[model samples]
Target: MSTTTTAPGTVPAAGTTPGAAQGPPKSRRSRRPGLIPTVVLLAGAGYCLLPVAWVLIASTKSSRELFSTFTFLPGTGFTRNVADLSAYRDGVYWQWMLNSLFYAGVGALLSTAVSALSGYALAKYRFRGRESIFNILLTGVLMPPVILAIPQYLLMAKAGLADSYTSVLLPSILSPYGIYLARIYAAAAVPDDVVEAARMDGAREWGIFTRIALPMMLPGLVTVFLFQFVAVWNNFLLPYIMLGDDEKFPVTLGLYTLLQQGASAPALYTLVITGALLAIVPLIALFLVIQRFWSLDLLSGAVKS
Candidate 1:
């Protein structure tokens, strides 16, 4: 074989170059989502939205139109339906709405206060039996609400408080999950050094908590408050088990009783549909209104400082 000498620093041809026998560079391939994932997500959204869509359409139909027409079609009796609902039993529906508001608003406020206090202490202080206390409270989360309702009703009865609004309101003010959420929020949001600094400045424990800690925990407390509000609003079993008087009924129980009566009176069916539509309106409006201010990051125990 004849040797070929090249100029200094000159590149040789591909086949002639030593150690240049590797394969070509691989190009990146497009990654398209598999068909099943897209379909499942779409299906889940459709499933959740189905009832809401039906309720909207059903509210518009007259008693006759509701049974006569297809489920999705709109009818001409929307205004008449609302008027009829308003006229029913001298507008007892509005009373139920007010009761629901009172329960949610007052109960949520109290629950948030309790949760904030307990959570702040639990997170910031190292006390004896802290783990035990937390574990006991967490056990409440596992207990079914139905299981608690019976005993709560019995206790309220023994206290002569049953069949009263207090029977409903009192039980809702202490939520274990709310406390848990508050603890997580406190641990994540309030810095220990900040608290130490406040203490060194001769601030009382309560003063430091009220002025400094509470403002930082506000975002988390708001979440706890909203959760409690919705829980009280949507609650049916507790109120149903505790209160017998229709006058004291919350909207959930009232609407349910109305639906039960629909089996005998189809006319009430229309009222039930209309009431159901109205019952969810405030909650939807509340979510829309507060969603703008709600800091969801606090829910997961993360804050931007």
Candidate 2:
């Protein structure tokens, strides 16, 4: 038997060609495309967060320090700013906060309820003109709220509801987008056989909906509520047009009024910044509280054998 001696650098692997240039694996190379999305996401996040950071830092500054200091630096006037804001107009800022809470909370709840009913009906029922109705709602969704603000104000004026909380609340309660979301969610989240079984057990339509369907739809409803709450909370034009009385103004309009006044009285600028900072707290809190509900998968046990 003859023995073959291989040179030190000339040994080939089992299948690879000898003297082939070794390179990184294909998987690592594929990950290079992900960097673009990551860069885009970081840029987007920075764009969104930069204003919030400026607001937070600016709120801490006194009027004199606000312009003198660096834009991102924190100052020592947050407490004083709060005090001045509270003292303004006998604490009307708190009233605006409460009005905003009422409008957002009540309007979101009512909108979610209406969306739930409308969505469930649209998903499960085979009524005449149902698609047409949903298409109309889609059209409403496409129509900007700014466009409707004038007509809504006029309607409220004709009905003697202008300048009242009811005007804001009523218009906010019927959200076409909310209804559309609910319809899509219901069709996906709910199983048709479950409804048939409930009906076979002699359950009334309302009972079946409340007891069975509602629980399954809770996550979607929460989303609708959150969206409507944020929309109503941040609304300006509708309230600005509908309300002449500053007393009924939601925080958004109230802040705008403050901003307008700040042009004349620069001291109110600090208050406006402080109020703007405070305005976002409830929304943050609400998102924190509501996020846990979204994790629940309620449909898992609905059709167990």
Candidate 3:
């Protein structure tokens, strides 16, 4: 048979010619979505969410029903439980709620503001001791809360601020972790050219910071605020050591107090559980509310040109 020659640069059909250079192999089509990651994620979700579900159901239960009924079973004592909580120790639970709100809300807001300002300064300004200061702050982050707590308490006592609202609120105001996050965000999100341009245009430093930098750093600030909020809200040891008065207690300490008494007075167990459920509602709601404002893209910042 006579042979026919192909074009020199002709690619073999399906690119399968022996000894030919090949592109990356085509990925195989999966018949279904990945099962292992899905299973793992679902397992993790269930593990976290199951306790929340238990609490919700348990809170609805009457004391007797709580012990007798299946854990997941619903009960009808939710209103009564709320009433008992309200009536307990002259409605002290609500005071704890308010105190928690103040500590977390005010503390987070102040911390975010300070972190934003400090982060921006560190990121944009050329100053002596910048790296040293940053390193010190970072070191603070590594230091355990336990290490600082007693010293903080002692200092508060010296200043006569201990066992007061200032004792709890003041210590939480400057968060090294928040500063670290803010510094990273500021560096990533704020461009040097923009800062220079603002300066050249005769904008004052504060003006540039408040008007130009703040908007760019807003997303990161919101993240900082949320993190600090959760931290302050969940903080137990600081408030526990600082405030001796029950009236000044945050919800965390209040819950701890209830839990302590719960060992002897088992009836307080339901109240503790109920209060815990209530405590987390604000966090969840804050998350949902903040979700609308948080932009992942902005936080990631512009890709390198």
Candidate 4:
């Protein structure tokens, strides 16, 4: 047997043809983000965070120093702002906060439940006009909530629910987007064979869903809950139109009123800023608390085909 003598480094390996051209060195290829993308991301971050920074800084400032000084400078009035906000109209700010929590909390829970049921049915059950129904929901997802506000208001007025918490809570409970998300998530996360196995074990539909499908779909439902909660928490238009009672107003609407009043008084601007800053705390805390649920691996021990 003749052996092929190979020169060090320059020789081809066993399979490669001799004198084959080599590609460029790996070190020459750049893996870092391009300058333009980096710039764009930085710009986007600044655009988003600048307002938050301003809110934080402004919230710490008193009304006198709000505009009189530099924009980003921190002031010494944070405690005073809190005190004034607490003292404003017998602590009505807290009432708005409580109202927001109610709307967002109750609305998110109900919406998530409806979405879970509707999505699971649409994804798993084959029925007549299922696609049509899903398509209609997609259309609803496309339709802006702003456009529906007037009709919702009209319906609520007709039902004598206008200016009540029920109007806001009821409208928030049926989220088309949440349903859409749930359906997609169910189709992806909940396996068909697992469902069939549950059926073969004589598990009722409701029991299978509650026991098996629900655990698998928990992350998606959490996402839907977060979305709906944030939407209702930050909602301004629907509540603005549906409610005339300032006492029932959510934090968003309450802040808007303070903003409008600030136009004349200018002192209320500090209160508005302080209120806006505080309004975001619950959402942040909620995200931090609920994020752990998303990390659960519920499908690890799922039945394998």
Candidate 5:
């Protein structure tokens, strides 16, 4: 082969010279951070977090100090608030917390499993009415829980499920959004070749799904679990409509009751604020524990299947 020589001090085209500049360098505008986006994000974070900060501070205040002192001022009632909340209704606040944990934990687990299996089948299998089924599921996401709650309650009442744990739970187990996420994740994270190979090895379909596909799809499943967990934990409307007993109440419902009581007795204002502050501790702890399972790569389809 003949060697190609380029003009002196000039960048050569590909194959003309080795290690030559290909094009002009990217501009400073392209490399530097976008100022507007950064400011907007900071503003959004502050807006969301400001109320939480207020709750933390306000929980520390006694009912008298709540209005008397500055908004951000710390009072000496932090421990006292905990004691009062603990003593209220024979520590029913803890019962509500336990109920919420049970509901969210069981609901998230069941939701994640169903979503994973449904998503995998939808993604991997070729069946009739598959798209229609998925579309119907997605339609549920459009219907807000507020609009659906009354109807759900009526149905539960007809089925003798009203005022029962099943009424609150069964409705929450099927998450349209979680199914959507799982489908996307399964499609992205599971390889067709791997699935085919498993089939050729005399492995059953369920075995392939449980052993081979599930491992690859774990990150996405974790994300679904997290979403459903938060949704069930923060849920108010379904429980409000379904359950009549205070013993079965979740933290959200319990707080609403306290607020109603606080309207009559201003002393309960401190209890309400303190309960609200304590309410978020579990979620914070959960985030710290499961933060690693949340990956942009899995969500954005950046990881190889």
Candidate 6:
């Protein structure tokens, strides 16, 4: 009487056939997704994208096609739409674009710098009133922009600086949320021993920060910069109230005025939509460009460099 061993994953010598000998029947759990979550997620994505999708499609249509045709289909008027936008008011749209760049670029750079310094200080140092200072800045985060904008406008007026570029750019530079993010980043990225090593080499505190901590904190700072950039770029009320001149308007306020006019003209509706589409183009482009450089882990301060 000879016995043989079966190969792995094969049926054993039970008193049954190959398919049935190895094990009991496997359970047939359903692999399909439940209806509710799938529907909810798809609905959310559609809700978020419907406006954006509409803008992209609408920006391609002429004023006539915009009203006459179905909403979702692309049109042949993209070139003409861009040309008309380019030709509008001696190309004031370009000026608004430039103004938005100036406000967001300058404001975000300054805000990131201040947030870095303040955050580094709070994270590393143990000076008197440190907690108090952080708490005060946190309070600024809770304060509504509506509340601050009025007082800021009043103060700028007293200083004879209302209706100017400075009035728009200056107030936005001190961002409490940016500081908060910076603090979290600094605490995580920066190490005590590195600062101690720098100090041992006779490096000043500012030198250590500029040379050592900043390089380590760069990834997180990009997030602050990007956040503040979008915030300033999209800001309408501050620039609207502070700057009366259309030439000084950022794209948001500028497009808003165009929309107001469109209420009567109706033709300007296409231009307004076109301008909005153009305004968002750079943001999408910037995200794609910086996405490679951004270390998302730095947002959580998980990186140890």
Clashing pairs in 4: none
Instruction: Go through the candidates in order and give each one's C-alpha lDDT.
Output: 0.91, 0.92, 0.91, 0.93, 0.90, 0.91
What TM-score quantifies how close candidate 5 is to the native fold?
0.86
lDDT of 3 by residue, 1-305 (tens): 75546679976577365555557555654634587789999999999999999999999987888877576878999999988998999999999999999999999999999999999999999999999999999999999988999999999999999999999988899999999999999999899999999999999999999999998899899999999999999999999889889999999999999999989999998899889889999999999889966554545555523
Clashing residue pairs, backbone N/CA/C < 3 A, model 2: none
Estimate the lDDT of model 4: 0.93
Give a tens-digit lDDT track for model 2, residues 57-84.
9999999999775767699999999999
> 219-301, model 4: which lDDT tens digit per residue?
89999999999999999999999999999999999999999998888889899999999999999999987875554334443
TM-score of each: 0.87, 0.90, 0.88, 0.89, 0.86, 0.87
Model 6 score (lDDT): 0.91
lDDT of 3 at 264: 96
Q: Where in model 1 is the C-alpha error above 4 Å?
A: 1-29, 34-38, 295-305
Supply the TM-score for candidate 6: 0.87
Residue 130 CA error for candidate 3 (Å)? 0.9
Ranking by TM-score: 2, 4, 3, 1, 6, 5
After the best TM-score superposition of candidate 6, give how far the Cα of residue 275 lies from its true spot, in angstroms: 0.5
lDDT of 5 at 211: 98
Q: Give me candidate 1's TM-score against the actual structure.
A: 0.87
Model 4: CA > 4 A from native:
1-24, 27-29, 32-36, 296-305
Q: Candidate 3 at residue 178, lDDT?
A: 94
Task: Estimate the TM-score for candidate 3.
Answer: 0.88
Supply the global lDDT for candidate 2: 0.92
Per-residue lDDT of 280 in model 2: 95
Model with the higher lDDT, candidate 1 or 5 = 1
Q: Candidate 5, residues 155-183: lDDT per residue as tens digits?
A: 99999999988998898889999999999
